[model samples]
Target: MLAALRGIAAPPDLPLIQRRNFLRVQIDAIGVGLASAAAPFLPIFLTRLGATSQEVSYLTSMPALTGLLLGIAIGQLLQKQRNIVRWFSAARFLVLLAYAVTALLIEVVPSAWLIRAILLLWALVTLPQTVVAVSFNVVMNGVAGPQHRYDLMSRRWSILGITMAITTAVAGQLLEHLPFPLNYQIVFSLLSLGSLISFAFSSKIELPPQPISNASRTNSVFTRLSHLLGQIWREKPFVRFVSIRFIFLIGTTLAAPLFPLYYVREVKASDAWIGIFNTAQTAVLLVGYFAWTMISRARGSRFTLLVTTFGVSLYPILVAHTHQVQVIALIAGVAGFFQAGIDLVFFDELMKTIPDGQSAIFVAVAQTLTHLSSFIAPIASAWLSDLYSLPIALTLSGIIRFLGFGLFLTLGRKDS
Candidate 1:
């Protein structure tokens, strides 16, 4: 209901806002627990249905591709929204239902047509997810208030990571023990229930009145974007941060296509091995979040981001070098440690740079750029893999990730 995003009134105090944040963390635990358990396996699912590496790239890239094309439009649209929570919940509910239905269909579809059906179904279901993703941020920012934001967000990430770490560990065992398709079917079906619970918890958070967006009337969105980019560039500290993020994102996208292939084809990892890899990373996220919290508090988000990126950059390199499943899991755990830093710090850095009175516009502009890179890199990565090899692609990704470290070196001392 639209009424949900536009609540009766702002909660009168900071305590109320923090209380809402606590509720979100609880709901997130469930939703993330289930979705994380299923999402990583999606590529694996396609492989089981006989999808080629190129086709797998399409599914992997679809969310970012969708964001690249629709992020600006939807983000701009959200700025005008009075009931963002309602809008987000509605979109999320549909995505969950789609997952549930697809899970059931997986049980009945013919083996030959299954992959195509899954691809088509995936596209249709995920269309609104970009809206959900951006709006959730917008709503959370509104709910958490400025004073409590860092602490709340840090705890939220830590809690969600803690949840995924546990659930993935269990899901992996279930997948390894259960028959093919059945394990997936049960987990995918659970996605809907978890999402529904999340939506319910999300609905309880009250929002402050929306600050009206000053989207220029005469200047087209693209023209305004050009100006926003210039403004951010002039804000040198923010520019340095975004630049590092841009490079880091490229590496992440580049590494995306190689993971499933490396584990399945190269290492011959079992289902439990896959789960342990994810669990290792997620378990480390708990450490990363809290440790980064202390580090960012003591040293600042920029310093924290730069230092942790070294660990982040090592993950693909680890994959490229190792064939042993257990080492891969350990590598994942190490990567998770850095991932928490990025997860906790990235938004803090972005929010720090946002011009007062321009949160929505700033977020939209950032998403557009980030999603564009994310969209292009996956397709390019697939092409690179097709021409050379997955190993080549993974090696290249490591090199790209390391480039972020180099860029961090150039950041002005004031940024730290």
Candidate 2:
């Protein structure tokens, strides 16, 4: 327990903190900036290409499904790689090119059927995309060290908030002004360039070399994965932590695929409205970094998580029931404040749960379960919204979130 407690303390020196912060922030700003600007908009773009409701959900869920399938393999790769950062760069750099091509081809193929083809090609890139993403936290943990995880995470997310605020504001204007499809084409291509720059910074990041742990490659692949699972099962606290996280995750993420449709159709929100909403949320979210840090330092991550999670649940539930776009948009900004806690603490706890040199194994198991949840969440939310009312499905999501928090409060109290 004392060992785990040490994970939350500040680093011993200033120089180490600064180096990690610089490299870490560059990675965060670029990674979250690209994904938030691109992936979330995919469902919106799918609708423009004449995709049905079902098709949008399938395409949205495809990436996470790939993550679920490939996470353990990526975990093993991380275990063996001499330089994990280079491996990530290779895969993700390819993705940036794929994204650029995807954006350009939208204008090239204006046909309705051809649009579907383009989107399918886009979905196929999710494989490499998933690979880089699963390894992301492991890289951060390796670089930041447990002592600086909270500092790195809080500042990293603040950069993300700032990036999203600017990107959404700018992209929203371009989409609103430029001609159909061409607007999306130009914007996505430009965002890919931003990621290209981030990669340049990523190459300069310094990580102490990790020697390969297991040299015996004679075993079959399934044999290796089965062995990893056994090791995780031995970690009782880690297993409990992951289980509680999934419950809350399911409750909140249930609304992912439904959001674009909900905002446009039910709330009748304009493109500009989304820009304003995201900007407002980011403003609060950015300021929230300092506040959550204080809370995490004083009250502990467990308390911060429990308190803020309840607030986070309200955003979706509030959006589901409300008809006023302006009202919900403000609510969205307030909700961003709570998300700061979740963001800062979630990984802090993960880092604490495992001993040193074990980030990849722990994160792989956690992400694999999360990807599985992401796979089911949107489909369930969509089906429920269709069968009953979206309001009903979203309300139930909020209620279920409280149950997760309740369980977390009970299970996490002792260690936290």
Candidate 3:
């Protein structure tokens, strides 16, 4: 298994620089996986802490709010800078630091203020988060270049998936076996150490210096802003892709908070079961990434996109009908398979839409649109879940996803 994974990830005949960067990218994935192990549990922790749905929705909504405000500005700022990897590494460090802060807050903050404090901490980190979001694509695209993106990302994400699977399983066991609050505190603190690993290796990723933008340093901020808008307007493909993706993202994000809420409230799943849920999904991604990469290679990204988009649209609806955690884990596994395809196709398609030398700014525009949906969807879903039932809200999510899938069937076929 390990050898096969290596065979898939590490293709031969690369120059020395790309080879080294590829290895570094995979190692960085391990660190990322470790840190991301804490993600599924954050909302679970909030729920256990007696946080209301609106407060819980803040986890998704706050970052989106900040991203909407800061994403484009950060993108433009990065375009001006010569070394985006520096910005990428620094931003990643701060974003991961929030988990460590959350760990400390569990010990020191008053019970009444804990949720607010965590939410505020996350909100404040959105600045760096925006930087990371913008710079990440730039850095990764630089590392993979045009020819090796699928190879690099598939291996990178596969490693990340396996790492996340193991760590999340351990985290679930720790949460089940260890005492409350302290178990969480320990898990968060230890998991946060992955940030240091991420920072160290990510900082070492060597990209050729970006050519500085020549947009006239003398231009007023408004002038530059107008220029940026003009650039985006001219990229008709990017505009159309972002528009369709915005709708798809709404369906995905609307179901985000509802899953944990349903698992915790409706299903009454234990911590161990939640871990299994995440584990099942992530473990499948290891296979999914490789499988979808082959499918994309053979059938093209357009076909892959249609199939995967339609496949994933069924996840929430399937979960809505089931009450058993075991069955839900199976459903999550199915979702993970298609989700891997979506990630690969989306990244490839988005990068294809971006013109050379405009990765940061173009990706920023996309992220800003994504944040717009992320901001509205979760809160809306939470409201729907609150007003109706979890199943009803989840069914609505599937319905919306089907609509996005329909758009893909028509508009997605036009992509080259």
Q: Highest lDDT among the candidates is held by which one?
A: 3
lDDT of 2 by residue, 306-392 (tens): 888888888788888788878877898888899888888888887678756766767878888888878888788888878987778
In model 3, pairs of residues that clash are: none
Cα shift from native, residue 28, model 1 (Å): 3.0
Candidates' C-alpha lDDT: 0.74, 0.74, 0.90
* Candidate numbers sorted by lDDT from highest down: 3, 1, 2
Q: What lDDT does model 2 reach?
A: 0.74
Per-residue accuracy of model 3 over 1-416 as CA lDDT, tens digit each: 75454444568777777777887788788888899899999999999999999989889998899889988888888988888899999888888878889999999999999989988888898889889888988899999989878888888999999999999999999999999989999999999888888888899999998877676367889998898889889988888888888999999999999999999999999999999999999999999999999999999988988999999999999999999999999999999999999988888889998999889889999999999999999999989998999999999999988998888888746673
Candidate 2 TM-score to native: 0.91
Regions more than 4 Å wrong, model 1:
1-14, 214-240
- Candidates sorted on TM-score, descending: 3, 2, 1
TM-score of 3: 0.97
Q: Number of clashing residue pairs in every model? A: 0, 0, 0
- All candidates: CA RMSD (Å): 4.6, 4.9, 1.8
Which candidate model has the greater lDDT, 2 or 3? 3
Top of the candidates by TM-score:
3
